[model samples]
Target: MSQTITQETQTPTVPAAHEAPPRGGKLAGRVAFVTGGTRGIGAAISQALARQGATVASGYAGKTERAQDFLHDLQSAWAGHETEFSIHQGNIGNPEDCRRTIAEVIEKHGRLDILVNNAGITRDRVVSKMSDDDWQQVIDVNLSGAFYLSQAALKHMLERGTGRIVNVSSVIGEMGNIGQANYAASKAGLFGLTKTLAREAAFQLARDGKLDDDTIGVTVNAVTPGYVLTEMVQGVPDKVLDKIKGNIPVHRLARPSEIARVVHFLCADESGFITGQVWGVNGGQDM
Candidate 1:
């Protein structure tokens, strides 16, 4: 099946029952690896997974101190779960690093269950002013990195016969941005990747006879968050922020945890049938 690109316009009104429990232990024995998880949305996703009883190994590029701090904070927050937190420092843009990171995680944890490709970088420039380097860097990290890591993790996931892969896409990837040509292309590509992988996984499960009337396992999905309040957006001018807010029905940027919660759901077994799809967490911006 071909991938479909979705332009997000509004925040989804999740039913009250779907709200994540405050101290629920839903992911009791899962293992997850979140890329660029040292800070921002990535950090929130890592913590959410850990809180739900998943052993999380987060990847970081250059933020050693911050990575350590995140690990410490997660350890304290989930003091009762016996959750294991580890930091894997590697550049996701490098395919070798991507492979090594997953290999290391499997070595330590003995298995891999979930892969979240959340590492991304932006090199904003108008078409006229954008340099080749600017475009290449964004593509390398935002797009290629996810491909590398997903390919690496696929080996393990396909072998294991059950897994979740969530790619962190963006609202701009759907609706073009003024100065984000490269970022938009990369994120758009991620939507395609998510769909293709989902189909492949479904076929593989069917071949293995894992898809029974009562049980259908394995899922792949994407989460496209709207203007989130992270350091990455701190560079936006006040006017730009105001304009973005005006576009959103909620009239506010999303908190990192809001996006994280959606990611957590997509990674859970409950979402096994929800594959080859993109869920937009925008606050009515696209509408």
Candidate 2:
């Protein structure tokens, strides 16, 4: 008789529950820290992680009241998980604040498993009209702040032998936009940082023989969103919004939930082998 590959003959034993869908997206019993997570896409990301059974700490740069409100809302949304959600106020643009914020989250949660560098600002102006302050402010908050916080969080993550870092970049970083030189540069810098850190973390894990360990390995990645319907975009004129919408293949702006889902995926164990990658969650927008 000839050996043939048949479903019945080749099938391997599977657990009873394996036939059903997964209970969660492989992120149960994890802790996540999201910077600039009080509103917009950041807030959505926080909620998504909490829903997946992860303790989340959201960092806010200002408006303590709003941050507290966001925390309360998330706590209610994931009430069954005993989800621990809190807000830490600090300017990520400042290195000292970044260090203190990371320390605070680790102290409160006992560990830091995920770090999302989502805090950013935009000072849009033409080169001829832009002031030095406008250029520096955007760079300081968007690019430099990501570096500071990542460095601080990496200290704990590296010690623990595992973590996830997700940097929020912009599509403009790849396809430069008019009147957004500063914003563009900062976002572009994040792309470089994401790749470099991913390599370094992978190297460390390999050296320690932890590269194959699922429970104790780090992955770094970036998510570049295109034309998200956030406070920043609300400032644009209706005509401008229409023009931008026309340029997008999807003919619409990305919902915060959409971007959050991708971030949550990267933070999950299922994405262990995916690092040093930039997942662009643009609504079919080029670049």
TM-score of each: 0.89, 0.88
Best TM-score among the predictions, by candidate number: 1
**Which residue pairs in candidate 1 collide?**
9-284, 9-286, 9-287, 10-284
48-116 per-residue lDDT for model 1 (tens digits) = 787687899988888477667767766666555578889899988888999999999999998889999
* Per-residue lDDT of 261 in model 2: 87
RMSD (CA, angstroms), candidate 2: 12.6
User: Which has the greatest lDDT?
Assistant: 1
Q: Write the per-residue lDDT of candidate 2 for residues 1-287, one digit (tens) a residue.
A: 10110001011111122212223646777889888777777877777787677888988877777677766666555555566788899988788999999999999989999999988877777899999999998899899989998898887888888899999988888887778889889888999999999999888778877666546478899998887765455556777778878888989888777888899999987788889899998887863
